[model samples]
Target: LAKTTQPISMDSYEGQEVNITCSHNNIATNDYITWYQQFPSQGPRFIIQGYKTKVTNEVASLFIPADRKSSTLSLPRVSLSDTAVYYCLVGDGTPSSNTGKLIFGQGTTLQVKP
Candidate 1:
């Protein structure tokens, strides 16, 4: 299983772009990197996913390097409401790790200040 490492906390101001990076040292070639956002008292919601290169959506953009060992989740023009705990996951669409079907990290807490 792939293991991820990320910062414990991050601080950002309103209207700022926040990029959270996650490192997966043991990532397999067939594994896909995904990011999820979670608010207090709520389950995590999918933010983005990528295998290689760049992928953008209405909410965020995912950037993966050629090595496929790390990825970045970029949130544009974030507001105070965007503050949440973000989790990085590695999986292959099957029950692989303790996270049922994915391997989830401890998560990174983001604080958006006004």
Candidate 2:
């Protein structure tokens, strides 16, 4: 299994953009890099996913390199409301991945100020 590592925290002002990168060195062949954003009291929401190259959605963009060892999440024009904790998780499974167990890291706390 691949374990993810990200920043413990980040600070940015309102109206500025933010980008959070995660590193996973032991990623599996069937694993796909996935990012999730969380608010103060809400569950983590899926941001984006990618195997390689680039993938974008309404909220964020996911950029994966060829080696599949690292990935970046780009958030455009962030605001104060965007302040929250972000988590980077690798491994894609239907009901579960391999043994049906997921190990999440401490998570990166994003602080957006005015």
Candidate 3:
């Protein structure tokens, strides 16, 4: 598994955009970069996933560099409700390759203030 490093914490104000970057220097060719958001006492929720380039969903956007060595999770117009821990996971997340194995490191804590 490729090791990922992220900021320990970030502060943002309501209606601001937040971009949290994760570094995975040893990423593999078949690995996919996925981001998750977890609130207090709740399971991690999928934010976005991508292999290369950019992917956007209703909630957030994920950008993976060509080297596949890093990714960024972008949240637009964040609010107090968006304050949570954001996790960056790198693995074979394809449906056919899903192994139900996920190693989560200490995630980035996002603090959204009013």
The lDDT, on a scale of 0 to 1, for candidate 3 is 0.91
Order of candidate numbers by lDDT, starting with the best:
3, 1, 2
Distance from true position, residue 79, model 3, in Å?
A: 0.6
Residues 1-114, candidate 1, lDDT per residue (tens digit)? 788999999999999999999999888767888899999999899988888999999999999999988899999999999999999998774444434367677899999999
Give a tens-digit lDDT track for model 3, residues 7-99.
999999999999999999988777888899999999999888889999999999988878888899999999999999999998885466568
Task: Give each model a TM-score.
Answer: 0.92, 0.90, 0.93
- What's the residue-level lDDT of 11 in candidate 2? 95
17 Cα displacement, candidate 3 (Å): 0.6
Residue runs of model 2 more than 4 Å from their true location after superposition:
93-100
Higher-TM-score candidate of 1 and 3: 3
TM-score of candidate 1 to 2 decimals:
0.92
The stretch of ten residues in a row with the least summed lDDT in candidate 1 is: 92-101
Better of 1 and 2 by lDDT: 1
> Model 1, 105: alpha-carbon shift in Å?
1.2
Considering summed lDDT, which 10 consecutive residues are worst modelled in model 3? 93-102
What candidate 1 gets wrong by more than 4 Å, as runs, is: 93-100
